[model samples]
Target: MNKLLLFIIVFTLFSCDSKNIEQNREYNYPASKVWKHGVYSKYEARDLEGVFDGLEVDVIYSPEKNDIYVRRVVADTSKNLPLDEWLAMLKVPSKMSYWVDFKNLSKANAKQAMSIMINLLTID
Candidate 1:
């Protein structure tokens, strides 16, 4: 009888611990998983840097420049920020990662875009 009681107590303790761990994991998930999309400007990124774990910006591949730029439309490429410049402005936390929403990432531009992105990232 004593052995059975001891076994029950240990089992109950272990079960409660596992349940609390699961709850903690779920509660902490959103803080790290939350993403802020359409963050195109420095002001927007600055405002949201603390509130979100990830900031996603729309980028278009500029064939003329053979580079990626942070902008929704290709028509106004003159005012659009270069992807590297946009990236440089972001003082992102170590927990955060770059999330570029490529508006015109095709097979033709993918290689060059990737290469450019790689260079930009490596420079940081």
Candidate 2:
């Protein structure tokens, strides 16, 4: 009778431990993971292929042309693409987000900036 009781106790303890371990294993890792990645100045249109979850572009208002342009320097004038044209070059994914850093815009240009951004973002 004592041997049978001991066997039952051991079996109960082992079963309880197994259940605890199984519960802990379920919480060992997260259900989902997120990654943040992007590019800097002078990034090519083709550079945004399957690698990034975001894009950061520097936008400066061109008072001369009455438009917004993307570049680190307004005076460099080498290979900078206007904001609309640059955005047109890439087919942005629905999941990807954009960080538009507006540079050197006056209060009057703010409305234009907002309008341009709204129009750009609402495009299909």
Score every model by TM-score: 0.66, 0.58
- Score residue 117 of candidate 2 by CA lDDT: 77
lDDT of 1 by residue, 14-115 (tens): 777543353334322345767888888877776776788788888898889888888898886565788777766667544456578888888988988888
Model 2: number of clashes? 0
What 10-residue stretch in candidate 2 is worst by lDDT? 29-38
Q: What are the lDDT scores of the predictions, listed in order?
A: 0.75, 0.64
Q: Could you say which candidate leads in lDDT?
A: 1
TM-score of 2: 0.58
Write down the lDDT that model 2 would get. Answer: 0.64
In angstroms, give how far residue 118 of model 1 lies from its true place.
0.6
Top candidate, metric TM-score: 1
TM-score of 1: 0.66
Number of clashes recorded per candidate: 0, 0
